[model samples]
Target chain A: MRISDKYRYLGIKLTPQRLAILSYLDGNRSHPSAEDIYRSVRKEFPTMSVSTVYNTLDVLKEKGDVQELTIDPRKKRYGPVNTPHNHLMCNKCRHIVDINKEFKFTLPSSMTEGFELTGNHVEFFGFCSNCRKKQ
Target chain B: MRISDKYRYLGIKLTPQRLAILSYLDGNRSHPSAEDIYRSVRKEFPTMSVSTVYNTLDVLKEKGDVQELTIDPRKKRYGPVNTPHNHLMCNKCRHIVDINKEFKFTLPSSMTEGFELTGNHVEFFGFCSNCRKKQ
Candidate 1:
């Protein structure tokens, strides 16, 4: 596969496996876990080990090319760094859907204490349609 | 210390170690990790082990007596389950401050995708005064 010019801009070494990982992540909204990436990419590069996926992800994370999310407690998930958005997650199944709108709100200074305030994210937790049906 | 009457309401057998863990978590907003609880509680119960803390936390989680938070990804943090609230965390220190106000939000159907939304929590990420000083 041809390496994208964007990978060049990231200033990381682009091995075949790294290129493959980056290609997989590009525009991937599934918010795949590392294991998910490893399982899918290994179909092409049979020699690809899980470690390679993690190492490439670490490099990309350092370059600010991707975001690592702890939205799911049992495992970490990755998504493209994009316009500021929040997530809605299934409390039972951990399914995630991106909410693209931005929220505008202010916190009481009493609650914030003396911390220098910054950006905020909202996480909506509930049963997804499928999980709700199972209930 | 007296075993508080609240523990009985949960209907779990409370061993001394379990009680110690419960006492540590009671009204505690520090969001202590299992390891943090083990280290502190062991100072009192010489035989208290880390696994015991984890097991007690698991039981408490099952009983819905305490909340398990993934706010700090490296380990699970515990917090009191009280009135609806949110958190502000320092990105550098991973310190959390409770935001005790509820946000009223409604999601557009296109964004929700048939999710049976239950609740939402807002997380504000920023540099705390201590971390800002170091920066």
Candidate 2:
């Protein structure tokens, strides 16, 4: 779906900044952080504030339109995909890619500590091809 | 192993502050962040700095004595467990627990995107019993 149509389908407000953000994220696989998104969009919207980017991301995350990844220790990365899957990140370049496959593993009921498992995310870390060549 | 003996095993300098931090983290399952550690340590030291906590954590992380968790979006949390395992977090209270079991998963070669898989961590998020009771 197009960016505008996606927000419309989700009943999100169609602001110009949001439109620009959605356009940037529509098929973005980099799993960009809020700063990355802000920097990317600011090229076109120079007056865009980082707080606005964070707020928009918060709304999108609350709406389940995007997945916020804690794969990187330095910052949170956002992905537009909603499918249940794991993430693979390059330890060298910090490049992130979606695994797009279900890695099902049952946490023994004994270890659950009386908590129900709603969902799980796996982050696999290694050197990407480019980073490997650099080393 | 005791905190002092653990640092001795890793050949880390045993400063009074590091000892204080390590003693605090010994068998700690709360997964406190750098700020959390700083705040906790400051109660006794009164003048302990956040940077000292972070530097100590960095050394501990490098020595493979602690694991840094990105489960919290606001900050990075640390665990003293060195075992290979996953983490479970309470989505409501932000409480984190170590899932001390092997959750072995294999990624098909097709999904690797030319990256070698070094390690993977699973973060399971849900409400804790206390939070559930509150609802």
Candidate 3:
């Protein structure tokens, strides 16, 4: 998708760096961190700073256009918002696989005893087929 | 529990600073971060360092004696491992409440198509009762 058009839809500023960041994230399932995005986008814009990538990501996250995943506690990973889904992280390789299927869960009364319900995310940790084969 | 005894169970070194950290973490449900623990433990052991807190947490985490939570994207929170459960974070107050109940969720075949599932966690984000009342 065109960067300017994406900015219009996301109601964000159309900066060259922001466009590059968004373009890199568009349909990206790798769930990259700020450093990952910075390294990839730097190939095109050598002058772009890591902070720019982080700032753009922060804006995208605040706008709900990008999802920040915590599957890996060491660093925050970003995923595209094209589809709403959970994630499965391979323990061996640390590769995050998108779980596109939605699972209905009836929260036990004890779990939601005193709070209003909002949004919930399920993170599954496992070994991918390739990783399992190595094991 | 006695710090030395706790260390014995955890198979960790029984140092004074380690004792202080373990004492602070024992039965702690607030899920404090490394900075939080450092500030609290530093009061008793004025010579304690932030690196000590992080190192101790890392050791405890590796041993499965503590659970590291990523409910907050900014920092890693530590919780006692007395029980296994999910978490609910209050968006307004940024308070993390423990949901001590097992939830049964059946992942659709497509979600686990190429992965060998190990475990999963449900992170619920919303406003707590107090926050909801204020809102």
Model 2 misplaced regions, further than 4 Å? A1-12, A43-47, A83-102, A105-119, A124-135, B1-11, B43-47, B83-102, B106-120, B125-135
DockQ comparisons of all candidates to the true complex:
0.43, 0.40, 0.37
Fraction of the true interface contacts (Cα pairs closer than 8 Å across chains) found in each model? 0.73, 0.62, 0.63
DockQ of 3: 0.37
Single out the weakest 10-residue window by summed lDDT for candidate 1 chain B. Answer: B1-10
What is the TM-score of candidate 1? 0.65
Chain B alone, TM-score of each model? 0.64, 0.62, 0.65
Write candidate 2's Cα lDDT for A1-135 as tens digits: 865676777677779887688778877877788999999999999999999998887665544455677777777888764445478877555687877887666777787787755667887766687766633
Model 3 agreement with the true structure over B1-135: per-residue lDDT tens digits: 754576676566867876677678888877788999999999998988899888877665544455666678788887765445478766455577777776656577676758876666778765677766643
Candidate 3 clashing pairs, residues 3+ apart or interchain? none
Candidate 2 or 3, higher TM-score?
2
Q: Ten-residue segment with the worst summed lDDT in candidate 3 chain A?
A: A60-69
* Candidate 3: C-alpha lDDT: 0.71
The candidate that achieves the highest TM-score relative to the unseen native structure: 2
Global lDDT of each candidate: 0.73, 0.73, 0.71
Tell me the TM-score of each prediction against the true structure: 0.65, 0.66, 0.65
